[model samples]
Target: MPKADSKFISCKPSKHGSTLEGLAPSTVLKHSLLILFCKDPSTEEPSVSGAETGIFDASRSFHSQRSLIEQQTKDSLQVEKELHLAKSQLLSKKIEDLRREECRCLLLKRRGTELACQILASKSEIDALEARHQAAECEYRQREIEELEEKEKTRDEFYNLRMSELEEFKESIRRFLLDNRDKVQKLQDSVSENTCDLLAMQLVLCNVMPMQLKSTLNLLQGSDGYMDNGRIAAAETKKSELLAEKEKLEKYLISSDHLRTLLQKKLHKMLISQDKKKTKALTKDQVEK
Candidate 1:
């Protein structure tokens, strides 16, 4: 029994073996004894002594128990090694999956950053375009204002010149009336006199032939008899001068009217051209948007 227990102690549990390492030595002995009982002896035991047979059985059982314990230890060690290997493989796979997930997340973050940069760049471009459009519009309006101011200045100058001409004309007309007043008074005085007195008055006021004067005086007497030939001639001459001056004024008025019409037409054409340009620019801008 002591030898059997010593042999069983030699069967040390494997470091990486199963929980069965705690099985009692008594259980191993029982198993071995059961194996012996179940087997048939090679020789008939009738001639054998009881003590020798018991000794033989005990020796055989010890050998069997030793072999069984060794085989069980080997199997438990193998199973434990396999379990550890399987656990290692599972942990490695999980780590690999985590690494792949981390890489995917990093790539996605980089792509998002690139997209944000592109969006900001596009927004800046749009802002610049808008600024340019506003500047162009402001410049166009400024040019239009300057053109209108220039036209107004030209119109003011034209009006000022026309007014000055009218002032000169009025002055000339007043001077002309003053110079002719004495002559007109003399002619009126002479018209009331007889032929001899008229002849004397004509010679003093104006150089005239007696025959012509007598014919003019008789023609005057036939009518209201207040007007003479000198006064009539002076009136006709004054009417001619006034008619000529009126014709000149009419021609100037007509020319000014034609100039104003031409200027208006030009202004309308320029406005239409500006509108067409603006429409084309707006159309292009819309297409870009």
Candidate 2:
């Protein structure tokens, strides 16, 4: 028994053998004893001894125990392998999920950065547009102011020129009125003298004509009366000539008065126009202010 145990313990399967190669030392010893019992009894010595029979029975018991242990070991190894495989697959899935999350985060960060840059660019463009609008508005206002100033200057120059011309016209009218006044005064004096002379001549004619007529009638009593008639006709002719001269002087006085009235009206119109122009200039100045 010691020799058999030694031989079985010394036997070992190769590293690249079957499942029995990985068995524990005690299991390997059981398998080796079972193999020895399976050999034909004829191949052994034909002597029956009580000690040998006892050894055979003990070997049989060891064989049954070895088979049960081997079956249990196989089932345990199968269960452990399945558990390891499941753990490895779960770990691989977790790694893949983590990689995907990291990629998603990187993509989100890049998109956020791009959006920020775009927003900044848009803001700069808006600022540039506002600046341009302000500049254009200022330029337009300046141009409008310059145009108004130019128009005002032109109007002032025109007003000054017109005023100068009006002054000169006023001076000429004054001189004409002064000269006509002296002429009118002389004509009035002449007319008065003529009227007084005519009145004196008419009085003398009235007194002498009747006296002469009466004397002619007395002196030439039975004569033809032709000489008396002729003398009367001559007196009448002299009276008609004096009346014609008086009518001519009256006509002259009427024409002079009409001319003076017309001159006064023209001077009044000129003064009114000047006042209106001054008022217009004042209104424009207020508006500009």
Candidate 3:
């Protein structure tokens, strides 16, 4: 029996590859020999008690180690979950920032495009306006030049007409003076011939014939009539000279009228030129504004 106890006490818990066989709880309680071993009546059977104590100790150590491992695993899992949530949040924020930047860039690009279009439209409008202004200026200058030429032409025409009229009036006065001079010379010659005939008749006979005397007296009467006519002709000549002087004055007046017309035309041209200058200045001012 002592040999059997020693053999049972030497048995160790399962730490090796194969398990050692043991009795069931019901079997051990029912057996009388097993009960004697738990009592440990003899001090020499202490190894036998050590066997049971070792088994209890090994089970408690295993349970404690398992609990520690389970708690450590739970903590690690919680930390990992927290880290993953943080990463997800950071990525979401980054995506939102990228979307906002893209939206801002698109808006800026659209604004730039609109500004370019507006600049182009304004440039085109300015070009068209400048072209219209240039055309108007050209047309205005052409009209001004034509008006000046027409005015000069009219001045020359009026001057020429006045000159022709003056020449015609001078010629008429000269003809009238020549005709009056010819008539006066003819009357003077007839009076001188009658005086010579009367002197010859007195020398030839103391008494002249009655009929001849009557004819001589009639000649004297005719000479008197001619002298009256000469006086009237001299008065008419003075009248003609006065009329010629009046006509000359009238011709000078017509020339004055033509000169006045020319002066008016020049003044009108000057006014037009001033207007053109003002228009050009106004156009420049508007462009600057």
- Among these predictions, the greatest lDDT belongs to 2
TM-score of 1: 0.36
Residue 263 lDDT in model 2? Answer: 55
Instruction: Count backbone clashes in candidate 2.
Output: 0
After superposition, the stretches of candidate 3 with alpha carbons farther than 4 Å from their true spots are 1-70, 162-289
Off by over 4 Å in 2: 1-77, 155-224, 227-240, 275-289
Q: Candidate 2: lDDT over CA atoms?
A: 0.66
Give the lDDT ranking, best first: 2, 1, 3
Ten consecutive residues with minimal summed lDDT in candidate 1? Answer: 4-13
Which has the higher lDDT value, candidate number 1 or candidate number 3? Answer: 1
1-289 per-residue lDDT for model 2 (tens digits): 3344453543333355433455687775575464455543234343434533454566667656767888888888888888888888888888888889889888999998999999999999999999999999999999999998898898778867766876776677578657766765765676567556656655765776578667766665757544566655765675566567656655655665576577568657756876786687678668858
Give the whole-model CA lDDT for all candidates, comma-separated: 0.62, 0.66, 0.59
lDDT of 1 by residue, 219-266 (tens): 788888687668779756865675575566556555555655665576
Task: Quote the positional error of residue 224 for candidate 1 in Å.
Answer: 47
Candidate 3 lDDT by residue in tens digits, 54-117? 5445545655676788888888888888888888889889989989999988999999999999
- In model 2, which residue pairs have backbone atoms overlapping below 3 Å? none
